[model samples]
Target chain A: MENSLITADAVEISEFPHLAQKYSVRGVPKTVINEEYVIEGSGPESMLLSTILEAVEKTGSG
Target chain B: MSFIKDADRPAVKERLRDMRSDVTLSYFTQDVECDFCRETRELLEELSSIEEKIRIEVYDFKTDQEQVRSYRIDKIPATVVSNGGASGIRFYGIPAGYEFSSLLDAILMVSRNESGLSDETRKALQDIKVPVHLQVFTTPT
Candidate 1:
């Protein structure tokens, strides 16, 4: 979400080992939302959106 | 040789035609050690040539200290897609396969300077006061 407070980055696991280990990314196509929510696989746009929304809401940050 | 296939040019051009502003991709790489640096640069070059509003600026990761610091790029084959300014959108590898579409989407978002988020999502984001770093990791395959 560029217009919002959320910033997005597509990180290559091989290049950034620290991040990969910090998030425990053992597989490809893992999406770490806000460093709090993890979506391990690919899905529809709605699914990704809802995943972020749910995670943020649960954490009471957004 | 061109990295983008000839068949892909028409559709790629059409998608980038709607860009409202000029988008510059700041790419950082080191020649000696990076595996995907050459390919990533070539891909960005080919993609940028497909649209007038798109531009690519290549930088040496070891020598371009100012650019690396300004963009906060900590890895090789890193690309920062920005339109008006830095939008915090980055790609840490070659945008190949399905990830190519992700780069296109990022370019569109940067050109429009809008997230295209829903009203509900926007409202929720409005409540967030701190910075949120959302990282999506994926392989080229």
Candidate 2:
């Protein structure tokens, strides 16, 4: 998974714009799964793999 | 304000019936004000009745701090669409207009326990280790 391009759109610039707001975003390309899991940003395949593994373990979601 | 026309209920319910997981929509709002708040509350209530698995819960925004805290809710007419998981995911402001599509997406995701995201989208979200807050803003059309 080469870093997915989930760029902050214009709303990010116009609505709540700030790098301090970066912490709020937590990380780029964050994808929320079932609203139960959230992946921060691009990482090594292992990182993403673990995130999925952990989310499944935690949520028991199909 | 029943934004969803009566004509549209059949399709929405038909689509919703495909869900295979437990789903609940928790609404937080104050009674005294906000025109959109009342509308949202009614819309969700009606939506809930469309199915048995689709449940609804309403709480006072000003009086229910504990409930609000549980969901980390910070806005009126806020909604937490959870798939029987821990709550906190919030849809701030009224989810009307195009944002309702997102609301429907969230409901389907929760109810199906399936997130059919692209591999690339999944890759992008696969390494988050912190609490990420996502706020999407839109105006009712």
Candidate 3:
């Protein structure tokens, strides 16, 4: 995803408290897309892709 | 202070051998120190030793203001995996445990300078008009 227009970052919650709070992250392995769609746990790759696409559609960018 | 165990080194080295381009791991740290800064640096150093294409460049977060700004790094234990270009790939903490494998995969991908994405994905990404930030939060577990 890094090569696309999508910029991916692996953020460690323990180091960045502000980001965790901003995203309302209460648990581990949270995937946040554009700070809009929040996937609580690690699921199938298709689920992750759909979640991101869903957010993109809602944001009127897709 | 070996982060990579002896048993894992052979396979890791074997995988790293596929590297075709140079990949520099630009690691940022400060004198005051963050929780895992030292460990992060050590891990990067060990990784660099595994392959000729891999290299580590350490910079202080406070002293190396220019490098920090250049890499757009704002936090400690930050690593920018780049190969002559800004790949927009970042690790904001120590790439340990399962994350270590992710780091290796990132290095390989950046070295190849390919996204390894499907044709559909490439077409889909082409449709994007704005920058999408994807942040994956995870622990070592």
Candidate 4:
């Protein structure tokens, strides 16, 4: 939500079973960027930013 | 029954005291068959009571088609935290337990109208030309 180009959704896996299954969220704090890059656990801010950038790159190329 | 404990009201109020602008929590829910919708609405009500700058606008997900489309909400019990503008910060379920703190932080962040990201990170985000959707899944614990 910080950036204008980004939309962030915080989903409680227990409440949204279908989403949990679709995202294959077996752990807490699983972050899926652009439905492409998945961060299994909580990471540093830099790591999340990098993953988002990488997702953007992949989307652009594909 | 109140969703927020009485003992935590003071601390929650203190935390919300940093808000510089009015924040609106646009909550979407329906009348039936949705889990945690009532609880989420009640939670937002209790939260709004703690700070005058915080307000909630409730909408029925089944009937409020225009709002649902405008907000781009795809699910029930969704809360879009914004300061009279698009913030893109949303919670797809009840923001309880540890996630409650995140809701508060989002409110404060939007009220202040600052992302609080590092300069380097902000600079790095400028290169992006496409929309990036981030779905973070977590449990209440």
Q: Which candidate is the best by TM-score?
A: 4
TM-score of 3: 0.86
User: Mind giving the per-residue lDDT tens digits that candidate 1 earns over A1-62?
Assistant: 43445667898777677888998999988998867788887876677767767766766643
Mind giving the per-residue lDDT tens digits that candidate 4 earns over B1-141?
A: 998999999999999888999999999998784889999999999998889899999999999999999888999789999987789899999999999999999999999987888888878886688889999997878
- Docking class for candidate 1: medium
Better of 2 and 3 by TM-score: 3
lDDT of 2 by residue, A1-62 (tens): 11121111101212233522543554334444434455555556656556555664565433
Candidate 3 CAPRI level: medium
Q: Which window of 10 residues has the lowest lDDT sum in candidate 3 chain B?
A: B117-126
Question: Candidate 3: DockQ?
Answer: 0.59
Output the worst ten-in-a-row residue range by lDDT, candidate 3 chain A: A1-10
Q: What C-alpha lDDT do the candidate models reach, one value each?
A: 0.81, 0.60, 0.83, 0.90
- lDDT sort, best first: 4, 3, 1, 2
How much is the TM-score of the A chain of model 4? 0.88
How far residue A38's Cα lies from its native spot in candidate 2, in Å, is 18
State the number of backbone clashes in model 4: 0
For model 3, residues B11-76, the per-residue Cα lDDT tens digits are 999988778899999999988778999999989988887777888988999999998887678777
Q: Write the per-residue lDDT of candidate 2 for residues B1-141, one digit (tens) a residue.
A: 467788988887887877887688898878795646787788788788776778889899889989878766655667787766653345655666656666777788767755665676565455544333333333334
Model 4 fnat?
0.86
